[model samples]
Target: MKRILIIATDGFEQSELEQPKKLLEEAGAETVVASLETGTIKGWEDGDWGSDVQVETTVDKVSADDFDGLLLPGGQINPDVLRLNDTVIDLIKSFDKQDKPIAAICHAPWLLIEAGLVDGKVVTAWPSVRTDLKNAGGDVIDRKVAVDGNLITSRNPDDIPAFTEALIDAVKIPAENVVEHI
Candidate 1:
């Protein structure tokens, strides 16, 4: 079975994380949620605190080699904070180094930029993050989903379906065979 590692922390976009996880599982993949700390992490929804998801493990305890892909659900706060952690950045870099699928939506691309994986890559993200991605040398587009090499990115919650589908496809096929966009 394909195993996906979902990394997030307090303030993740509720639907971005939950919907993709549900769809991935339904598509026959196993997902493990890792956070900055133990226990559960809260989500951000509609300008307020939303649901909580259990943290199966901490980021520092996981490795890119153990999972088939990485899922990064974004919220204004989630990626903003996660990007500052060295451990989180290192983990993201590890995934990129292994050429594994790294699916990031909305502001989650901020983490990708921080990990220095955006250069020369085609990607999409929340509008506010487009400038950042461009500044980081990424070919930013306004599509619902964009895939460049092993990096997959989406714009926002509304693009969750396409984003999730892209990730599932990437996981089910060899990296070189994955589609470029959706």
Candidate 2:
């Protein structure tokens, strides 16, 4: 099974993380949630704290090689805090270096910009993140989802369905190719 790594922490947008995770599972991909620490991470929803997701592993304990794809869920607080983590930035860079699929939503694109992988790529993120994406040389759009090479980005919570589909498709395409070669 394809394994997708979801790297998040306290204050993740509830739907953006959970919905895609559920959708991915339904599509036959296994997901692992990793954070800076163990235990559960609280989520933000409709302007307040919402549900909590269990962290299956810590970021320091895994690498891009551990999963077929990387998912960066967005929330106002989640990316803001994660962007400051050098280890998180480095892990993202590792995925980019290998051209592994990396899906980010809303403010989560901030981590992509920090990883220096946004330049010259077409992407879409929450309104607040558009400027950072542009400043980093990305071609930002207002669309629900943008797939540029190995990177996938979506605008907001409402775009979760499209975002999830894009990610599932990304993994499926590669898996299909592998099966054909075998």
Candidate 3:
């Protein structure tokens, strides 16, 4: 089975992580959740605290080599806090250097900027972070999803379907092709 890594922390947008994870799993990808610390991480939802997802491992212990793709789920606080961690930034950079798919949504694209992967790339994020993305030399768009080489970005929760599909497409063969052979 293909392995996909999700990097997030407390205050992640509840839907962003949960929805895509569900989609990826249903599509046959094994998903792993990594956070700054082990145990459980709480999510934010509808203007309040939300669900707590069990953390499979801490980011510092896992490596880009172990997974085929990277996912960064965004909420205002989640990416803001993660971007400040040097190890998290370096890990993101490592994934980019390997040319693996890096999918980030909403404010999660901030992590891309901090990792120095945003410059001159096309990306999308929450409205609040578009300026920051532009300032970092990213060509920010207002679409539901944006694909730039190995990077994938989406605007918000409503974009999750396209976002997850794009990520899945990068790491797996298309189902239509399998059906054709069958």
**Candidate that scores best on lDDT:** 1
After superposition of all CA atoms, the RMSD between model 1 and the true structure is 3.4
Which 10 successive residues of model 1 have the least lDDT summed? 173-182
**lDDT measured at residue 59 in model 1 versus the true structure, 0 to 100:** 94
Per-model TM-score, in order, reads 0.94, 0.94, 0.95
The alpha-carbon root-mean-square deviation between model 3 and the true structure, to one decimal in Å, is: 3.1
| Cα lDDT of model 3 by residue, 1-182, tens digit | 87899999999999999988888887778999999999999999999999999999999999999999999999999999999999899999999999999999999999999999999999999999999999999998999889999999999999998888888888874564322110
lDDT, candidate 1, 75-180, per-residue tens? 9999999999999999999999999999999999999999999999999999999999999999999999999999999999889889988888888844443333
Q: Write the per-residue lDDT of candidate 2 for residues 8-89, one digit (tens) a residue.
A: 9999999989988887876778899999999999999999999999999999999998788999999999999999999999
* Model 3, global lDDT: 0.91
Clashes of each: 0, 0, 0
**What is the TM-score ranking, best to worst?**
3, 1, 2
Error of 3 at 130 (Å): 0.5
Write down the lDDT of every candidate, Cα atoms only. Answer: 0.92, 0.91, 0.91
Off by over 4 Å in 1: 173-182
